[model samples]
Target chain A: MSRTTVVAALAAGVLLVAGCSSDEPAPAPSSSGGAATADAGQDHDYTVEGFASSVLGDGTLDDLEDVGSASGEIEGGQVEAQIVSVVADAAGTELVVVLRGDDTGSPSRWSESRGVFTDVRGVEVVDEAAGWRLQPYTILDVSGESDLGCACSEFPYRLGEDGTVVQALLPPLTEGTTSVTVALPGLEPVPGVAVTWR
Target chain B: MQTRPRRTPRWPVALLAAAALTLPTAPAHAAAAPEPGSTVDVAGVDVPVHGTFSLRAAGNASRDLVRGAVHGVRRVEGGTAVYLSLGLPASASRSLPLSSIFTRSRDYESSALAAVTLVDRPGMTAYVPLRGGDAAPYSSDVSEFRALKPGELVVLWAVFPELPAGTRTVDVLVGDARAAVTGVPVEDGALEPVADDLVPQAGEGWPKIAEGDALAGAEAPWSVRPLVQHRGSVDEVTDVAETAEEVDATLAADVLFDKSSATLTAASQDAIARLAADIAARGTGEVRVVGHTDSDGSDSSNQTLSEQRAAAVVAALQPASGTAVTFVAEGRGESEPVAPNTSPENMQLNRRVTVSYQVQEATR
Candidate 1:
């Protein structure tokens, strides 16, 4: 376990024992179902392995709702971007993570394959420090389409808690720039959840 | 002590009577309220799970005090709910699963208490930790208590905050535990309007009002004022409010009928009814009923037929009680047909009425 996980576990254990008497009867098993797998320090990449359900600590991630965006190209089709926002529900138990990004391309073409397609699936965080804050990372990773005998034709991917990431894979673009927005509804209950960029 | 007054002796009798009533009225035993700052341990986490719940006062605008223990918290995105549990044998900690229940009352504020219970058996007697307090109305309180049952797991409920009407964004939090933030677009009860005043007639395209293009084209004889666009059509321009030039209320219908047939078919009537109702409710723009026919018929015959048809429709629409009805009957025999008479389908297209809309003369 990383230092953060160890610290969180110790802190949680101490708080739990503080209020109870030493001789109090041991707590019975709870009827509520199962425990979540620990998600400490696990930054989600658009890769298939990064999309599993994991437990998040308190104050780690911020809840995001109703994410949407429009695509814009800058830096000669090398960089792309989208803007997003969400509402706040105090009783929520998880943070909603949304991703929307586009690849740079020609202005006249309406299709995305004719240009680079930078999306939330193409960018991934490589390394980070102990307290790296997370911004909305629209683009997750980027891959060159030239390897597949297709110029500018590339697929973009994103992560969803609903296990829809695999089924909802994006296809290679046709031309210009393509914008993809991942909207996750519902509540998030974690604390201090952050995203890192490589 | 010494007897000071003889008149005070009457007070002793009154005290005896009051004691008799007050003694019986008191509760058998007052239940003590739980102390503040309690903690619940579950899975590898400690939750400060106790707090006072209450609704605010009235006259300060809102009411509906909601307070109570609800079902457990579930990760909607991840599809998991957590229940806190502690074991006596220090090394044997386990995570419990739980669901959620939500409740609210009409009043803006009220108080409720919830207890967390851990059972030895799935459905047997369990350990319960109770917390009680007042809550605001319409607020949903979720927690980890459930109706007792053999197979039932953990349950929790929460008094969630208010949501806005249309697509809304909200962050769901537990004290400070952010379960998740989702951008949910609350569905407004309002019916979204489909494209309106669509003039689909051939020959005359929609008019060009400023930077926007209407159904004024060479193919469609009748012009349409596009209201709302769904999935984006050719003539529909989003955000046309700023640059589009407004046009005068001319003939606004998707169709023009043949002379003197007051018979509006079932298909044609549906479109006309929608247009008529839209105009009547929106503004003072009245429907102008014009009738035309193919050159196969005589002038006098066509003229009368056109007049009869226009009148029939005007009668059909009996505009909302006070709406003005404008029926103009002009017969142009075979003058304009949307499509060429080469195919039967093209001929049928010409044998119809056009519907369109313009700003009500009064509103502009």
Candidate 2:
């Protein structure tokens, strides 16, 4: 068989396995079912070769409120973002979100190009009276270190699905422990997620 | 402690005699209360260069201050010569070491500890004391390294060449401190006084004026005068003083060059000349000329056209001789338009050229 055909066949086989091993629960079906299919397909295992391993540090995980996962399809593949934790520090409180993407159609493309958090837009957290748009922290280097004389990285991250994971640092939040709604484009709002600080 | 001799091999006593004849004596004006703006610190002492007039004068002033309540300044052949006077406070007991006062770097041509430079100018030029001849019009004493005792002033001098014409005010930078000198009038090959009150008053501190506040309190009468009207259909020049890295000038391409052509029109020539003059009057460094185009043409064609236009501007800015300024050209084509190409006016805004120069303050 031709090289192009061989590559395509291999990509399909990998996607089939990834799609089956997804831990995400099957999304509820709707009359249109378009959004459901897109969300279901995006929940596949994105832990590919070049992805970041963990977004949370050893002890920082205890400070976060797990708000569950949200998914959407983008230009080259599917994107999944999970609002895992929130931590308050001297600078401000931040949302620690883990982001992953699956692109079985072209696994080699992911090998060449790593992920960037700027691709995700319109993600926000809303309280009953006010809403704060989440902006990606962008001052970190490749090793996740902030060179701005700070002890830790202040910027967000973009991770590939090759067994890699990244902790995306969202903008600062002023409200204390409260129920907030997390909204993503083309996905239902995950409401009543408690944002508690440690 | 040793008292160092002021004469050096590079300077001869015979040349000093000739200079004394031509050098203008210090003006007899009563020493006004030290203007807070003229003071700059050197080592641990306060140095103030006196006079409140603009340097944009027609004739060069023979004696000027170099801050620190001492050192003198004057117009020399190629550039300006500043006489550095190192002194100690009267309360001091023994002589203080020169090593503690000035930097001792291998980069300088002289063993002296301190160096002098213009504020915005780049490249580090060592301060060499007067080695005799017509160069040291004010003093024949060569600059040297020596310990200073209480109530004594040690004078050293250095010369800076090729300052642009019509330069009215400039900050004389030494070590980490800078003293602002105003009214050292420019001699444009002839002597004629041009009245200018836009001179900035130095505040009572080192590096007198703060960044982004060059014109903050310049509410003098000259600033409010109406701008001289130009004679063409040319668009007004827009100057935006962004950060130190970005250029402060924006020129509309439509006013400078014909459509689809890189050649400058008569009106454009006038604009470019004024720009070149301004660059010279200020400091010198690397100049970036970037060109942009409207989205009407193909991407590749537009890129090539933009590049050509930027090169044309670089060619026009080349100095006649002995200038440190360098020019570079770049083109962004239709990709980085400042405005949408929906209307004629919007497209006109996109078709323009920007000029910026680098500032080398750290080296000074």
Every prediction's TM-score for the first chain? 0.21, 0.40
Estimate candidate 1's alpha-carbon lDDT, on a 0 to 1 scale. Answer: 0.24
lDDT of each: 0.24, 0.39
Residue lDDT tens for model 1, B288-311: 555544444666775566566656
Candidate 2 local Cα displacement, residue B353, angstroms: 1.0
User: What C-alpha lDDT does candidate 2 achieve relative to the native structure?
Assistant: 0.39
DockQ metric, candidate 1 = 0.01
TM-score for candidate 1, residues paired by index: 0.22
For residues B1-364, write the lDDT of model 2, one tens digit per residue.
Answer: 1111111121211222223223323111111122322332222122333322111001111111111322334444444444344334233345655443444434333443333433211111111222212221222122433554443334444444434453443333332112222222222221111112111111111111111222222212211111110011123543333222323467789878899999977878766877787566553677888989999979999999899889888888766212767888999898898767988988998998887775444422
Q: For residues A27-99, could you state the per-residue lDDT of candidate 1 as single tens digits? A: 1111121111112112111011111011110111122223333233323222222222221122111112222
Candidate 2 B-chain TM-score: 0.35
